[model samples]
Target: MFTPSYHDGVIQHLITDVSEDDFNVAVGGQVEIIGWLYQYYNTEPKDRAFKKKKYLESDIPAVTQLFTPDWIVKYMVENSLGRYWIDVLQAKEDPRSSREIAEDFGWQYFMPEAEQSDQISVQTNADSLSQADIEDVTLIDAAMGSGHILIYAFEVFMQIYEREGYSRRDAAKLIVQKNIYGLDIDTRAFQLAYFSLMMKARGANRRFLTLDIRPNVFDVPESGELTSADFQELLQSEDEAKQLDYLLDQFRYGNEYGSLIQLDKSVDWSMITRISNQELDEGQLSLSSIVLTESQDKLREICAVGKILSRQFTIGAMNPPYMGSGKMDSILGKYVKKHFPNSKSDLFAVFMERLRSLTDTNGYYAMITQHAWMFLSSFEKLRSVLKADTLINMAHLGTRAFEEIGGEVVQSTTFVFKHQTIANYIGTYERLVNFDSQQKKEQAYLAAVKNTDVDYLYRTNQANFAKIPGMPIAYWASANLIHDFEVGTRMDELVDAKVGLQTGDNSKFLRIWYEVDNKKISFRSVNLSESVKSQKKWFPCNKGGAYRKWFGNYDYVINWKNDGHEIKNFNWPNGKQRSVVRNPSYYFREAITWSDITSGSFSLRYREPGSIHDHKGMSAFSKDHELLIMILAILNTPVGDHIFKILNPTVSLEVGNFKSFPVIKNKTIEDKSFNISRKLVQYCKEDWNTFETSWDFTSHPLLTHIADDNLSHCRSPVG
Candidate 1:
């Protein structure tokens, strides 16, 4: 018997004189010790020491009050029991069973001890196995949290045994003690596993005291008496001190220590012996720290379990923790790298390694994990590895699977892998479907295959699986004709002249232009182009209003003039000296249009809307002006839409205010009614031809030509 202390929001400790009933009462209510342990393990640490720290609960005392949701347990039991368990353990099965026949006929097989026996027996038909034989198949939930899957498996096994003429009580007891095995990082979950199995065994036989007899098959003491002293002893060793120092150094350099450790001192030594004593007496305590320590220790324990299963059982199942790379601390990262290098590279990668290590060459492994590893670039290496090793029978469950956890609307997929010679499973083909709140949307366009040929099938509803081909891609011209021209030109030949100017103080100058009243615009305006009338209007800020004062103090004004002469005229303020000017300047700005073809590299102009025209013989007035209008009009037409579709397809083109070209029905050419100018016609025809050829679109060339021609000619004035 023990007296329990409930303080500090926890059951701190239990004094002597507490009964087993009291122990169960103290730790087995709705607010049980396991629930408290889970709450503690999951609670976010406020201080730096445990801010991002993760703790496991295996080290704490066993308390069977924790249980996983029943539905999940049922699913795991149905899908991962019998041969599934044997597959996990790599054990051999009877040759006369359906498993052997199934394996021979291209179905996935699971058999434990196949390798050790050097012989495998596979069943091909489901009806071949008798209820007695089915009951002989043993299973284990290697990392059973709260006994969900384990208990579910036990119930299933009991059903098979009862159908074989065995009494429910006898069969259930056998199922609990001999048929099912469970391990967990949380001692509370382990206890739950133990109790849940017992509860399942008792079933409707709860009234029989003989059936309620306690089994000693699985016993995890209240305080973890067996491991507490050993762990504490390990903590006191000089080797542990050295290891701690190494770990601390690694953490410091790796930038992980600030949140994992509080001080250099060792763990509380006095607590170990006390914890052990409490365990023997079935004492009660908060057990948070102990649980965390045990959880960490379970990483090794899980590995040990893997080793044991490799030699013992045939089938196994687990819902392993889903941890992202962002959560890995330096110490854990180091441990993962040292122990599980392949998994250390990526989360999914580690899972693959663990699965391969645990399952036999002829076994199956299945799990539900983050789907990002399927398509994200960071996991490409892991993907390559998985593709090389096994075929995946996958079903993607969209966002709804985790809606309660505040999880993102991300896609998740389940992968089922069987180690066999067959290339594929012989069931229904799988498809991807989005489970919306009320209905499901089929995402058939996203389907793809690896090495196997997949048939495309469609389903009108979510109940069935169907395959669909990849979506059709639409491509078009990505840039203006200027881009086509510049693709092969030299830099010197392309650029004609260059100018350099500074705002003196860009921030201050911009402030004067932006922060001042509307009237100040006249003062801040500077003459940048020729013509006194143009200059006066251009530098409207200096002409008269409040803004005139803002520009009055400027030392110089920079302006350019087209003198209609060999050398264009550039003027600087009277007091200022000119900067260095070059002959055959390296860059010049010119207007361009849809009709005037240019190099593809000129796509850069799509952003700036100005090009450095290098054609030597074209008339500047005729070409530049027409180019400007045509460019602006083309930008408004579907031709421009096509261009944008090709270059920046992901970006929406509906942004910003811009001038548009109106649709003109017809334009007369000579005596005939031609829809557009001859030049515009040719340009439109060429643009359409380019789009058709580029995208491999099958359309009437003439119609596409006419539509583009009419579209190009339609133009509206730019403000």
Candidate 2:
């Protein structure tokens, strides 16, 4: 009835120009198609947002859009929503476990709890809770990107309602109107979710498209030019006025904050819904009653959003955005820092806490987030909060969990947790980190599920994580390893691991040894004062280089002339000093240093006296030189490699990581280690001296004596 010719021509062009296959996919009746469409549609914007040196708050949806794989969606929904119904049934009459019931319901992705032995430390009361009426059970996805999770949840809810004596058609409509709820900040994401949910319901009920059933999915809208005074004239009570005011102020940034906005849980949204939609008789007709009756006004939008955020869900699931605090703009960073202080390190972590709070007590929250929070020290407080909840299951997808994003930069883990704590609850975990691709990871997870004794599957009590320093979720660690953490001497007690300086402008103050005047460089300065006394412009520096062990990576020289006056005085226009001189006394103290942000095995190399280190090249020192070598030797062992990865599985390792490393004081082993370390260092140094990249390099071994092997001793290998 209302059509504009100009927009109609654009629509005609869209219909005529697009490929038939694309149109077929739109009508494919598969909800997953929407996620794929969104993935490809926002390709350019996502790339642009990521590639820009400077990003804006507007680019959050673009950069964080990830099309969750169908298998992962099934896994998340089958475990959370499916488990909810299963638990309900199990708690009522059926003696079957939640996993067994899920199997009977044909939830293929639901993993059975691993077999725990009698020798286990503690027991749990996992099945002693009551569930809400199946009709009242609801699932909400706060970060419902393209509604992938919500669609799968709809399928689960439909199955539950159907088995509970309702017809498929009625179940579909009920699932849309009552069961599945979703919220997203981005307009495009919200639109896709709305359309996807309708299509999903339409598949189960053929005539659903002609019906007036509205899915409980709303796009978060900002409250623009909205004020409490606008509704004050109609509000009958002061509490209503305050509620309206709170809604307005909370939703001012609703478009940016979305479901993270903590709404007044005390507000009766169901009562508000009834009052707003009630048919007004002639006698009951009044301005105050019409205050919340405006369907198309900002009040309605605010009320709709408030209704979703005001109540906790029986099951909350999402694949929240994965942006580090470093990438966030000041507005988002500070807001998260202020509210979700414990999980302020990343967007996913922040949303984790948000979702947990939005879940009902004794309910469940399921999500797939970057695995950094599972181990990073920055999330210590978050881990502490999680200690109160019981972990149900986990699928550790280390990397390549998403088809769009590749490499080790964004490792992911999917998990489901009960909102209540269960003492010594044994959580099942699928270790898919070794599986390189999505297909391999999925297959590995299923394989681990099928075989209880599979090497990839691990069952552990979450309380054991707290026994270690920083409380890393090292599910694969042995009981002995955990005990070692409690009994063994911490590495911090054995040696002083110090983070070195930041020259700020490495290009200005640093150079390859070959890039500087040889006469101006000092190879041996015992202290910072000696550098100024010797009048050398450049001193050997240990800015972390590529992975190497025992010795070498000594290729750069730093300008430390006159006690680094030029570097220390380097400042911005705001008079903020650019350089950071940390642990200045340890500059030339002969420590073992390791490179930061490494992808390979952890390796600590020996650094000789007279050289300073960089922030990336963290240094560990001991007053006894032999003891330092022994410590380096022990830290470089295969045992150390395993322990270190458990400590901080992410790429970045720092001084703090080493401080928690478990060490035992065994004199015999220490002496043997010291001798072995001494020999290894000598051999590594000799080999390093022959390499062209090494500062000690004199000449190539081939050029030393290739002409006459019998007389090779004459050149002394020139190393």
Candidate 3:
């Protein structure tokens, strides 16, 4: 009897001694490992029963590496393979009969088997097909891991066959041999495939095995039996080497590199006792050697068979391995560049090429792969090539195909491409096709637009309009209004006179005062005396009135003190001492407001009302100041608003670091907001001999018209 132990919620085998009965029980599924507890105990059964009991008492980790849950497998199988099975069954029945049956069942009828096979073959070949014809079909997964897809395909085929009058037994064998094929780099996976197929075949007649295993299964035939050599000899001399090379290459790479190397590295070579000479003689090669060579040779033969099959069946589907482009090192990158030059040529690209090579004209191929190929700039050229050559039908799968298998985070997309067709059916063809195509040229004509005016002359066009086609439009801007204004005049050139003054860290130098004794205040050019009766109410202040001091005798001519020690100073227009009165207590009732007139002050002061200096005696000529004020007012008019809105759509008056500007808005030339003020300043600085006469404010028709229009519009809305 076989006994098992449980540890950490896993079942393990307990018996140290092994026998043929135990092996048979495990392989035959007589004693199954039903859950996590079963697997742990079954794998580690040799310890004392109590020790095993203690381990089993421990809690299981939240996650464990286990086979995929059956329900998920069922869902994926039904959605993908289920639909495929129906197509195959419909193809086998009479066309009319199938159509009638499909109408009743609400399913699509499949084509005749011969036609279906021929179409699949044609679709795999790239030369004779266009992008449209093969878009609907795809190849099945060729190298599915764990036989997940294969098993699912089998189940689907079985359902279809049952509906078509075949018993589960017959259908099982047929589906294994014809509908599904699988390959894996692991020996264990290969073993699983064989076992799984055997389980499916259980209900069939024993004779069914002979037929199911005949075509591809290789075993030493009777002494005079024919071999691969016989088949090679039958082909034309010209084709023989090519076929042999293909076979040899497959053998060298497919199984040798894929499975043998893996096994040798994993298993220990040193092991036990030999049987009798006869028994040894019967074995010929060691189990390892036989397995290594046979598996390798089998893969080569499979590739050769695939080439032959391509001539017979065209449509192909696969969920190829997903690896990021970053993983492609120099060697693989160079190889892809050399051989698959016309193709996109990544890992997925190689699969696509292989599938295409196997198909005939009008064949179809489908795959679920990484979605990065769609919009990535690196793949843009590749997308262009595909757009020109194949019709692609695509749907994005938002996440990794197998959620539970912790691998890379990948977004997937399903692509269906037809080998050859006359018309394109996919929606993305326009985007994928290169701009150099005729279609793009036509679209360009429709989207081209032209605009010209005095202030601005330019053309506008959409970059991708050719792929989409439409008529071009025209836009016009007003002629140069600024043509009359001098362009290069600097600020000094525009003003008759200018002055500069330093405020000397204005925040520390400026005086701030607030009134507490009177409801009203006044300013005058006079000095206050300590002897005044109201002297107690006045305070020499600092920093927005937070600090104060009593006056005293200190620089008495330009500065004075109300008390015995504190000093107070007065500000003069030009930093020069020129005063008249030492005391005017009544007139010193309020604080004086000072101003700084550095460069651009007059222009800024003219535009902003509260920016003027009250005590500065030097003033602009009456005519010049009026002109400056008028220009400033004109800038705020509706006409100016309209012109700026059209020319500088993206500009905001708020000041900060400038970024995120629209590309188009940066191109316009007439966006300067202070142009009018600068022009008025230029008019003011003219020496009658070198410059034109400054026009009287009454003679400027454009400014007057704008002012009049604004007034009329403003009053029009008044009640």
lDDT of 1 by residue, 1-719 (tens): 22354542233343233334433422233213333445345333212223434422321112212233333333334444544533322233443543443344222222111111112123322233322255446564544556555655555666556655888767766676566665544544556656655655555356434655553223211222223233443354665545434332323321121111122334332332333233322346547556644634532332233223334334445554445444565554665566564346544456555554555444455555545554333444454455433332444443444433333333444445544433222322234333452123122312322212334321111111111001001111113332432342321232221222222332322232233443322332122222232422111111011111001111111222221111132234673433322221212223221111222211211111111112211111122333333333334345544433332222111111011111222223221322223245445434433443322234445555566657544433555
Q: How accurate is candidate 3 locally (lDDT)?
A: 0.34
Top-scoring candidate (lDDT): 2
* Model 2 segments more than 4 A misplaced: 1-29, 116-131, 236-242, 264-296, 703-719
Q: What are the per-model numbers of colliding residue pairs? A: 56, 0, 54
Kindly list the per-residue Cα lDDT of model 3 for residues 1-719, writing each as its tens digit. Answer: 23354432212332233344533422322121122223243333323322332212111111111233232333334433333343344444434533344344332211111112343333232332232221223334443434544554455556566766887766766666555555444344445555555654664445665664622212111112222343332234544444434444433333212211111111111110010001212465676555444443443444433333334234455555433334444533445566555443445655555555544455455555555454433444455545433433333332433333333344444545655542323222111111332333223322321111212222222122112111001112223322212232222232322111123333432223232322211122233442232344233221111111111111001112242122223346786533332222322222211112111111122311111121221112122544334334333345533433222212221101011111121212223434554454344323211322211122333334566657666446656
Return the top candidate by TM-score.
2
Better of 2 and 3 by lDDT: 2
Per-residue C-alpha lDDT of model 2 across residues 114-224, encoded as one tens digit per residue: 555555322233344343477799899998988988877887887788788999998888889888899988888999899888877887899999999888888887876
What is the total number of backbone clashes in candidate 3?
54
Candidate 3 similarity to native, TM-score: 0.38
Candidate 3 least-lDDT 10 residues:
269-278
The C-alpha stretches of model 1 lying farther than 4 A from their native spots are 1-73, 82-136, 204-312, 345-349, 384-392, 407-410, 424-432, 437-719
Between the candidate structures 1 and 2, which one is better when assessed by lDDT? 2
Please state the error at residue 494 of candidate 3 in Å.
36
Kindly give the stretch of ten consecutive residues in candidate 1 with the minimal lDDT sum.
463-472
